[model samples]
Structure formats: structure tokens, C-alpha cells
Target: MNKSELEKEINEASERIKTRQSEIETEIDRLGEQISKFTNWAWIFVWIGAFVSAFALIYFICTNTEKGFGLNLLGDFMAGTVASVWSLAGLFFIYVAFLGQKQQLLNQQLEIMYSQLEVKYTRLELSGQKAEMAEQNKTLRRQRFENTFFQLLSNHQEIVNGIDLKRVRDGSWTTSAEGRDCFSTFYERAFPKGFRLRKHPIEPTVEKYAEFYKVNQSDLGHYFRHMYHILKFIKKSKELTKEEKYNYSNLLRALLSSYELLFIFYNGLSEAGKPKLKQLLEEFSMLKNMDFELLINIEHKKEYKEIAFASSEERKKLLRTKK
Candidate 1:
């Protein structure tokens, strides 16, 4: 059953058990009081009968001795007959007392059974509560992961926009390095001397512009760091859905599909920075074979291929294969 249904069922069961236990306890107390009263009355009656029998026997012996141990009205069998009748009366009382004790014992046993059943019901109720708590914890964890993923996606927009593929394709941000060692001091030769901007919009296709061309650009470090953390989070997260992973991967692929943008970013990185960029690509597993031209052509078509569901581990495997 679903969580709410299961919880409701468990609560109902617990309430029923609690009510039954309370009723059983009430019955046990009632039976206990009744048994106590019966025991007291039975003992009082038995003692009274014993005392009267003793007095009668003593009087009979004293009065009948002078009459030759026999009564005038009764024969020699008179004493024997009286004794036999008294023994039968005592046996009847004993039988009645025994039956009362048996009834008390049976009630006590019934109370014990009820007590055991109550304990079992309590345990069952506790188990249900624990199960519900566990499910809630799982749901909370999944929700947190989803929130973090969306936040990262929102933050990465500025970084993605920095690499303007259209600008690179249209021959913007070009400068002259007319008579200098273009290969050795490309950065200095391409831009105006001693000119520095806080942010330069570096095109992704820097290879198309053979010389170092600097325009207003922002620091790409934050963007890369954010992307790295996102990948790591996906790798470690147990709660993310396969479809969620696929969507994240698809977003990365969309950024990479821009031919000039991908080339410029990869080509412009320093020797040390190249490996870090490669590592980032591997994390996203976006190096997989994706025909950008074909995708663009089919962008508005109904027959366009859909992104496939993939987990973080499965996405990592894509990095092992060359594009």
C-alpha cells in the first residue's frame, strides 16, 4: 500500500488493539474482585460449619455416654448414621469450594493470555511507525537532491552564455598582431597594449580566430567548479531518478553541441587546464557521439530522438569510449 494508506491502516490496528487491551484489563480487574469476595465468603462459611459440627459432636458424646452410647429413640446404628450424613454434607461443601478455585484459576490464565496479546500488538504498532519514518526520510533526501540540482542548473546560465557560438562563427572579437612573434607572445600581440578588462567574452571556437583575441570576459572558474560539484553530486546521490540524470546529461550535451563553443574552450585552455577540462567533460559524459547538425535539423521535427534514461554510473561509462 501507499504511505498514507499504510500509516492509516497501522493507526487503526493500533487503536483497536489498545481498546481491546483496555477492555481485557477491565474484565480482569472485575474478575479479580469477584474471586476475592467468593474466597472470603467460602472460607467464612466453612469455618462456621466446622465450629457447629465440633460443638454438636462434643454435646452428643457427653449426653449419650450415660445412655450406653446410644439414643433411646434410635438404636445402636444411630451414631453411625449421624456420622455418615455429616461426612456427605462436608464432601459437598469441599466440592463446591474446589469448583470456585478452578474458576479463579481459569480467569487468571485468561488474563495472562490477554496480557501477551497486548504486548504483541504494541510491538506491531511500533514496527509500523518505524517503517513510515524510514519512508519519509527517503522522500526528504530525494527532494533535497532535486533542489540542489535545479539550483546548479540556474547558476550555470551566465557561464554558458559567455561562450557565444554565434559571435565566433560571425568573425567578431578579432585583433591584429601584424609584425610580432604571434606564436610566442600571442596574448600580448593580439589585444591593445596594457589593456585589461575584468571580464572578456571568450568565444568557444577560439581555433577559428588563429590569434589570441581578447574581449570582455568573466572568470570561468566558478562555472567549471559548479559543474564539477553537480557531476560529483549526481555520482554520489542515491535518491536521484534515472530520468533526472538523463536530463542533466542532456543539458550538458546542449552546451557542448555548439561546434565553435566546444572547440574554442578546449583549444584556448593552457596545458595544465586541458586535463581539468577533459575531466569535466568525462564527468558529464558528454563526449559521446552526438551529431549536432542532425540534431539541429530535427530540432522542430516530431521524429527527433529522445534523450535516454541513464544513471550516474552508467553515464560515467560513456567517458571510457572515445567520441
Candidate 2:
């Protein structure tokens, strides 16, 4: 579920609750109106009774006032008192009716509040679903990418290229001017540098590989491009020619395998990662009498550059144990 879905469900639930609340309000209103009508009629009847009694008592007093005029006047005063008391009773009933109406209004408001809470509950549920969906998509993509990356690795099985060169730069998402998110964060953190080497063309360095194994990146694209064009070739390997396939295969295996293997060896032992520096006098086959003393020269300040081609075996012999 997504945010909107939960919100909508909440809205629906609220509407239902509101509708019930409206019905309750209607019932309360009806009862209130009836109570008001009864109170009004009672007051009218009390006034009418007072009027009829006053007329009859006046007629009787006038016809038989030979006993005492003062007593007749007192009887008329008592009749007036009875009428006022009945009127006061009607007013009391009206007050009770107002109290009932107030209670009903309170109940209606409570119902509305309850409806809103239900809406909120639905919204929360939907938000959780959306989060779960996003996570699942990330997991699926990571699994797919891993399978594909490894598949390319298996086809091309070259060791690390010591002479290979690569460019390192920032993981600028300049192309994706839209914005960056967690995905971009992942990629940048994982591949902090962009190194595009020839022998290790579009390299994913040993350091970066180790990082990826530890956690998934937020995004795979940096500078709005892939790790290499090998990515495209990997995707279309089935349709690519043999040379294209081998190129991708070799690229992936040469860089990735060495990177992964290097980390594995590092994890297996502590000293394996950072060995004491050593130097070889000659990169080729070791000579016995040539310069054995140079091995421990301890002069690390030496600069040399060679621009030439060498076979795999020749390059291996050239790998002096870095001092």
C-alpha cells in the first residue's frame, strides 16, 4: 500500500463514521424539537386553565358574597398562585429540554472526532506498506545486479592489471539534475572515486568492491552514466558478437575478480593486507649476482616510468614486492 491509498481509506472510514454521527444528531434534534413543543403546549394549557378558573370563581363569588367579601378575594389570590406555579413548571421542563439538546450536541462532536482518528489509522497503515514496497524493490534490484555483475565476471577471468590505468573523480550526478536520494547516497559512498582505467577500464576498485559487499548503494549511476559501457554489453550479451562478449567478460573478470579476491585474502589474514615494503632489483627473472643488495636499499624515494607493452608473464615478473 502507498501513502495515498491509506489516506483514501481513512477518508472513507471517516465518511462512514460522520454519516452515523449525522443520524444520531438528527435523532437528538428530533427529540429536542418534540420536547420544546410539549413544553410550549403545557404553558399554554396552564394559562388557559387559569383564565377559565378566574372567570368561574368571580361569577360564584359575586353570586354568593353574602358570607364574606374578603374570603372570596383570598380564594381568587390562591387561583392566581396556582397558575403561576404551573407556568414555572413548564419553564423548568423547557430548561431540561435545553440540557438534553446540549448533551446531544456533545455526542455528535465526539463522533466526528472518532471518525477522524479512524482516518488517521488507515493513513498510517498505508504509509507502512509503501515503505515496505520501496524496500522490496531495492532488494530485488540489488539481487539482479549482483547476479549480472557476477555473470560477467565468470566469463572474463583475468587477474588484476598492475599496469592498468583508470581515472578517479567525484560521483557527480550532474546528468540527473532532477535530484539525488538514498540510492545516489549508496553509490557515492560505495564508489567514492570514479576510476576509469584502460587495462581495468571502468574499474570498480578493490576498496569499492569491499564496500559494496558490505552494503548496497542507493544508486548505480554516477555522473549520469554507468560504471562502464560493459554494463550495456552485459545487458545485451545474448545479441552481442563474440568479440563484444569477450571484451565485457574480460573486463568484468579482470577488475572485479581481482578486487573481490584481494579483499578475501585481506580478510583471511592481517599482515596479508599491509605487508612490509620490499623492492626487486629487476622485474624480470631474478638474477642471482646482479643486485641482491638493492632488495633492502630502503631508499623509497625513487621515480621511474616505462611506456611499453609487456606480456602477462613479463608483467608478473616485473611486480616488485612494493617496498
Candidate 3:
């Protein structure tokens, strides 16, 4: 063949190769499109599986009613209605629970708003009442301070004199203010400074017993409550092994002995003093499973008779002063 004829044949072959490459790229693009379509529809399989599961579960529960399986028009219109009702009820419950929660949140928000409004009104009333007595602002501030001081004093009166002269010289348990007690020492150890006591008397606002009354029974309430807690602690602690419990009980006995002074002071003769003592006695009597005698006589730590030793005269005196 001549040179021109050979060139013409090569050009035709190159054109055919280009056409085949374009066709192959188009086929790859078509396959990629098919993959994307399948990915989009993959969620259908999940729903289909979930629906089958739900159907099976409902069927099994219904079939296995206490009376064995029933059939031959078993899935009648009534049965379908029952199934639908069951499904709807389940969905309805979920919906209702969420709505109830939403309603509770709304109620809580409303309560907060009401509380703010009440506090605002109370402040306004106080401000109005005190404005005329503005001249005595210093006295009011001082009274507020005194009220806190006396209130604290009454609460802590059970502590008696907590002065350990040796510790005072050492400055270990000593503070800048009045002497501290064992309870106070424990309190500071357990918590950070300025944390308030968990419990308080019922009448927080009554600064003192009214009308020329001496603060005779300062620690009466504190001691009574302190006894109750110690008893409860003993009861809970007894759940440990017998040996551990016995050891712990010995420690508890010592603590109770330390607190006996408070009990005696309560039982002493005074109107306020007598009533408070009676309450503690009543509380002590009602303590569940706390056989004070059982605890005291354990392994003979010199059976300290004073812990439970209440005389008949003291009992009679407490009993005589009734409501």
C-alpha cells in the first residue's frame, strides 16, 4: 500500500479506540448511579425488618394467652381490632407519658414564677413597714445580728462548756470565737467551713422563750436529736459482721457515756428542763431494737450503770408534768 492509504487506515483505527473508551466511561458512570440508588433505598430494609419483628412479638403474646392458642377465624375482625387497639394503646401511652412530662415542666415553671412574685411582695411589705423606723436602722441591723447570735447559742447549748484548756493552749480545736465541742470538732472535720447544720428546731423564728425568761434549756433540743442519730447509727452498723459490730458498739457506748452529762442536765429540776428531758426519754424508749442494756453489758467494759440508770423518782417527776 502507498503512504497515504496507510495513514488513512491508522486514523480510522484511532477514532474507533476513542469511541470504545468513551463507552467504557459511560458504563462506569451508570454503575456508580445504580450504587447511589441502592444506598438511598437501604433504609427500606431496616423498616421491613422492624415491622416483621413487631408483628411476630404481637402475634406470640396474643397466641400465648393464659388459655392456650385459639383459632379457626382466630384473627377475625374483632381480633384485628384488638390487635390494632393494643398497638394504638402502646403508642398512646408513649405519647401520653411525654405530654404528662411536658405538663409537669409547665407546672414547675409556673411554681417558680409564683415563688418569685411572693418573695417580691414580701420584700416590698418589709420595706414599707421598716421605712418609718428607718431612724432605727442600726438597731434593726444589730437586732438581726443578735437574733443570729442567740439562735446559734440556743441550738448549741447542749455542748455545755467545750473548753479544753490544754487544746486551747495548743490551739488545735480552739477557734477565734467561743470554745468548741466534740460535735463541733467532728463537724469541722467532715465539712467545709460555713456549711449549715442539717437539722434545726421547729420554731426557727422564736429567738428565745418570751417575757423575761432566762435561757435555761439551751442545748435540750440538740442533745435529744443527737441521741436519736447515735442510736440509728448503731442499728445500721450492726448489719456488719458480729466481731466488727461489737468493736463499733464499744466505741458507740463510750460516745453515749460522754453524752450522759447532757441527759442528766435535762432530767434536772426546771419547768423547761423537765419537759425537754421527757421528750428525750420518750424518744430513747421508742428507739427500734436498741436494747441499751444489751449494748452496755457487751464483753464487760465495766458495765457503766449510769448510761441507762434512770431512777423511778425521775420517771415519776417526768410523768407528773403532763400536757
lDDT of 1 at 289: 45
Q: 161-252 in candidate 2: lDDT tens per residue?
A: 11122234485323332122332333344444333221221122434444554442222222112223334535454444534443444444
**How many residue pairs clash in each candidate at the backbone level?**
10, 12, 2
Which scores better on lDDT, 1 or 2?
1
lDDT, candidate 2, at 146: 46
The lDDT leader among the candidates is 1
Model 1, residue 114: distance off in Å is 43
Q: Candidate 1's C-alpha lDDT?
A: 0.47
lDDT scores in order: 0.47, 0.42, 0.39
Q: List candidate 1 segments past 4 Å from native.
A: 1-132, 161-219, 241-247, 255-257, 260-277, 289-323
Residue-by-residue lDDT tens digits, candidate 3, 63-161: 767655454344453355545555654554455455445544643554454344334333433645445333333333343333333333433342534
Model 3: lDDT of residue 40: 39
- List all candidate RMSDs to the true structure: 39.1, 34.7, 35.8
